[model samples]
Target: MDVKVQKNLLCLSREAAEFGPFDAILELEGEPDALWFYREHVSRGVPCIWRGAVAHWPAVSKWSNDYLRETVGSKEVSVAITPNGYADAVREDLNRFVMPHDQLMPVSQLLDVIERKEDFPGICYLQRQNSNFMEDFAELWKDTDLDIAWASKAFGAQPDAVNLWIGDERAVTSMHKDHYENLYCVVRGEKHFILLPPTDRPLIPHMKYASARYQLDLASREFSVVDEKDHGVIPWIPLDPQKPDLNRWPQYRHAHPLRCTLKAGDMLFLPSMWYHHVSQSQGAIAVNYWYDMAFDMRYAYFQCMDAITDTVAEGNCCAVGDHDIEDEQELSTGKT
Candidate 1:
């Protein structure tokens, strides 16, 4: 690492430690007005929780397993399958970053796997983030509003995508940042989030890993890692927030991670470009809205900082300017 770049990172780490939001995420007992949300949380790029924000939504109580089975059971849905319940995460065993094997199956079958009613070969999660709620699960639309009126008004537009999430306890979302302002609501079980503000970017490490995918052998109930050489290499964070290996990535010791749990009916406002890792209780169900982020001065500054971090970590200053930064939201659904 270049001495100047290392010094810059050290300075950033100190700044975050001295002046960052070291406290817990601000919690609001009820929903706030659009303008207040825009000014306090959105514009400031901070996270806050609205306790029981969506408690009134009928889906909170009605979207149970029986309800889902009766509604979308027959419909085929896209499911991300992995042996370890990690989709689009760096797998140290394979020494590569692997993406889940997408499988199409009936909603009932997927529920069976989640409910442990059947002995499934792999961990299954309904985490397709391409507006799957609006596009695929139309039957459940009436249960929840299409858009959050306050949030839409605050953002000055409707969400670009409304994602539906349902997964097992083991299904963990790796730590990463996204380009969209996210509003996440939990309707079923609980979701635990470990969040690090964008200011902590310098302390977080990034590495390029070989691209790969998981493939399952049904008859033998075995899973194999397949390399995707065509896709070349991909950059990913190898650190596990639950148990970060400080020895390998020592800079991470300076990071301050704020933890929060969103239970049924609670909503979380996750600002754009904030690094977050998520875990859930068994059969946790949630929905989230992704609003396009403004590519203004803040984004430009973040990009510049990202470039510097990459240069310091890799000893290749040109690496950042040469490649387009991959959209973290596109590859993963845990933007919240």
Candidate 2:
């Protein structure tokens, strides 16, 4: 099939129009039953918001600055530091996909950086995802459940990792997808997410960039991109959803994006493989459960789609770092 036809079928505008305003997103009033939740949302890979789902968790009420300082203050934790707050994102100027420089700092010091009480050179974000909650912050585990009951039931497995996120307002998570079904719960402040469905993979351009990491010189307080010679080229999406350069990535105009904000006590069910970019209110604190996704038929289909996308990209003579192809026409006039 032609690319246009494929794009149209992928977007499914006729069905979306029929759904009307609901096409924006689905919101759940409260926690859902396992069977119904799996059948309606999880099975179909649909995203939803569960308002006040974890409102009753003790952390939501007791996790004030003083409380956290008194509890886990002196504990040294891993913190991702970046000068531009764009950790694990494409550094266009350097032509590389750069990772943040991770440093070990006391929780109290990290909080001070986030609160602007300490004048740190780079943005500090405590975003270690290696089950940090169950490890470094184990003392605070009494405040919240180890696992989300309904979500664990729906996924038929416990979370592979539970991560705690505390970051400055400038710390931004670049557009990326994960292989795990994610349940992100905001415990303090708010988080804004820009989500794009996986079907838009073709429209969303991907380029291979050299892998690098930001390294800060402690004495100079300056950051430098250090290339990881062994890591090779990393495929990443270069477009920034917040300020998309439509002229360069004009095909992205055909993609549709959903925007949502999750306040404290709210939980977001972000399905596996859904591309998302996230930013947060200053001192935003969140916990996310990563459940391993089943490598079932859905995953198989996505792999097939991904292979087809690569084939199309190759046929259009799209280079490694540049995706724009003049010979390729616009597919759909949906939304940017």
Candidate 3:
């Protein structure tokens, strides 16, 4: 991008952080009224945590490792296996965005892999997002709510999907945005989230990479990235928030990141289009409801911003003249 455009983008990010209501995530002692939730948080696209909101959930206490092993141990379910813990992330080594190899295995065996009680060739994660909890683990639905009552009422519809996540610390969810408003509840252990607002889109680098998948070689007990020529290229964020490369992505320096940890029984209201990267404690379990976001003016404005960013990134737009240098200097200096 042109230097002037980059500086302006940086300025926009700074202003967002400065003008935003809370520097850190706001925590609610309890659930708010459905009208308040929709009016304040959902409509405004703000994130908040409801402390111990799901504490009364039966799964929070009953879904122990032994109990899980006893309840659904013999059931065959899909598991994501990767050489490294990252399931769906940019594999810089291969210059491709690789997805984990989906393997079907018994729940008991998967638990053994998670606990390190058995030798496994790859890291294992049960992270199927296709409403796997409802589809496969129907036995466990009795332990948790089918849908958050307040959330459904606020969204004016039931969740499109309810996902179950069971993974260890090694499994990491790469930074990305979703199109659905999310209600994430931690049932066991802890979940760490690094969040960024959608307004920081210009500061975050989005690159196109070929799609690939990890395939394990049973004979060699190894994994390799196999390109999916038919899938074509995918747009993804390459920058890692934990260890950012400032030299390549200098605009990210101006971006603001909010960090929050969700303990067992905690729930986070993640607004649509917000960027989030996640990591979890060993054997952490979570269930999240995805409600489709409204295609309102907010989304329309974001789409416009995204188009402008793409144009700026491609250097298709003309640079600001020398007369604008003073304004650029002011932006860089954090001056009005």
Reference-based TM-score of each model: 0.91, 0.90, 0.93
Q: Worst ten-residue run, lDDT, model 2?
A: 319-328
Order by lDDT, highest first: 3, 1, 2
Runs of candidate 3 exceeding 4 Å displacement:
316-336
Task: Please provide, for model 2 over 1-336, each residue's C-alpha lDDT reduced to its tens digit, 9 standing for 90 to 100.
Answer: 445444544455334434433358788887799999888878878899989999999999999988999999999999999999988999998899999999999999998888889878999888888999998888899999999998888888899999999986899999999999999999999999999877767668888999999999989989998999899999999999999987777767767788999999999999899899999998899999999988899899888877877777767743222233222324335432
After superposition, which runs of candidate 1 have C-alpha atoms over 4 Å from their true positions? Answer: 16-20, 316-336
Candidate 1 structure, TM-score to reference = 0.91
**Alpha carbon lDDT of each predicted model:** 0.86, 0.84, 0.89
Cα-lDDT of candidate 2 = 0.84
- Leading candidate by TM-score: 3
Better of 1 and 3 by lDDT: 3
TM-score of 2: 0.90
lDDT of 1 by residue, 43-93 (tens): 888899999999999999998899999999999989999999999999987
Tens-place lDDT per residue, model 3, 1-336, is: 366665576566667777765389999988789999999999888999999999999999999999999999999999999998998999987889999999899999999999999889999999999999989998898999999999999989999999999999999999999999999999999999999999899878898999999999868999988998998999999999988887777667667789999999999999999999999999999999999999999899899888878888787543332333457558767665
For model 1, the run of ten residues with the poorest summed lDDT: 319-328
Report each candidate's C-alpha RMSD, comma-separated, in the order given.
7.8, 4.3, 3.1
